[model samples]
Target: MEKVFKVLIFTDLDGSLLHRDTFKFDEIKDYLKLLISKGIFIIPCTSKTEREILEFNHELGLNLPFICENGAAISGLELLNIDLPKELILSREKDDLLNIFKNKVPINLQNKCKWVFEMDKKKQSLVFGLEDKKLKMALNRKYTIPFIFEGTKNDRNELSRIIKKDNLYLQEGGRVINLTDRVSKAKALRIFVRFFKKNNKNVKTIAVGDNYNDLDMLKTTDFPCLVFNDKFTLDEIPIDNLITTNKPSPEGWADVIKMALVKIDKN
Candidate 1:
């Protein structure tokens, strides 16, 4: 007997799903609802903070896990899971890391640039601050980090250097370096997949994103959807199972999902 497969859609928010500036995408709501009706899981994976994701979850009425802070944290409902896997704290002593950040590149923030920075305060992860236009602009830039990290190779090297040997994985997201001694997007997703495999009647995994930062999760899934646009520098790697949206941002994302599901049905 062949088992039916279910689908999991891990969508990136910034350039992948929403419009660059305004985070409004209504055209895709119906498609999302249709997927939900068919028992498909839609997970919004992003470099956004928990608070940022919460707002989206609220608006979309989605209760699935969200990848926030560049996979540094994966949360659902009331339970918050950190990739670090350590005793969660506000901040930690990262004199070496801090020094590297200071010397390599200026934080590139301005007075007007607002942000809710998540940093280690006493070995715990903490989030604080208001939004700033400067920070917003920095996040919108191609690379959010100090060094020239633009691809999987560059990112892998930098991750090895900046983090302690014990703390291997790191996420350079939005405008912050999510440093963790523990897990990664791909790893966390494996866990999520296990849960789905056991609970769901059928399961499928779909990953969507538009930047270098999304490389891990995109590679992890069976389907990697690239939200094509001019701003993002995507990999030229040949992955046969990819869904390139017809339109960038809201419209494109909507079209890709609906169209992919249609194609899935056809085949």
Candidate 2:
């Protein structure tokens, strides 16, 4: 007989799980709890800082491990008392990455982009569409530096080229662009999947996202979901098993998860 596989759902936050503007998951709170009760592990794989992801974990009462800073770091295994093969961190430290950005990026390009941390509370609130308190939490970076590019497309491309020369990269999310070390959500997911399958030979992974940064993670999962993002649409991903939700999240998030759960049960 074939062994039954445990299911793990890895999700992006900004425009995939939380409402892009409000940043609330109230609409799908119950469904989330239902998945947890059904023994599905919901891991938030996001560009969000450790502080922000912790806040969400506390709010949702999820003790599972999480991927933070666009796969720069992973934590919470100690909470679950699970020892892994190795540390799950993939990117350089936040300050180190920032130092590289500050040194490598040209003064001209630096002036063209508004570094998020340089902005005051009011300006951050306006740019991020978050309240003062939430913006404070969002700025707690330990790996990635989030920013808004105020330059033209050509300028942004040029800036990216310069950053790449130093082995760094930019990831454009739903609301902001971020600079970080050579790490990606997909790389972190692969590490976690290996650890998970060590305990359970049969395991299935699900990934959901709604933006360019999420492309790699979405492609890496057995079940891939493309949530609707009004801000940007993803190009066609060459996954044989892919699902696109009808509406944007948190509605789309709930819908896709429900569909995945049903399919998992049937299988």
**Top lDDT: which candidate number?**
2
The digit string of per-residue lDDT tens for model 2 on 143-211 reads 888889889999989999998988889898767899889999999999888777667788888899988
lDDT of 2: 0.84
lDDT for each candidate structure: 0.58, 0.84
**Residue-level lDDT tens digits of model 1 in 1-267:** 555777778888877787755667777777777878887777787766566666677778776567655554555622222332222222223344444544543243222112223223321121212245423432332112222233466545654575444443455554334444354566656666665555455666778877767777888987778887676665576657778865778888876776667766654
Cα RMSD, each candidate: 8.2, 2.0
Looking at model 2, the pairs that clash are none
Candidate 2, residue 260: CA error in Å? 2.1
Model 2, residue 100: C-alpha shift (Å): 2.1
- What value does the lDDT take at residue 27 in candidate 2? 84
Error of 2 at 114 (Å): 1.3
lDDT of 2 at 46: 93
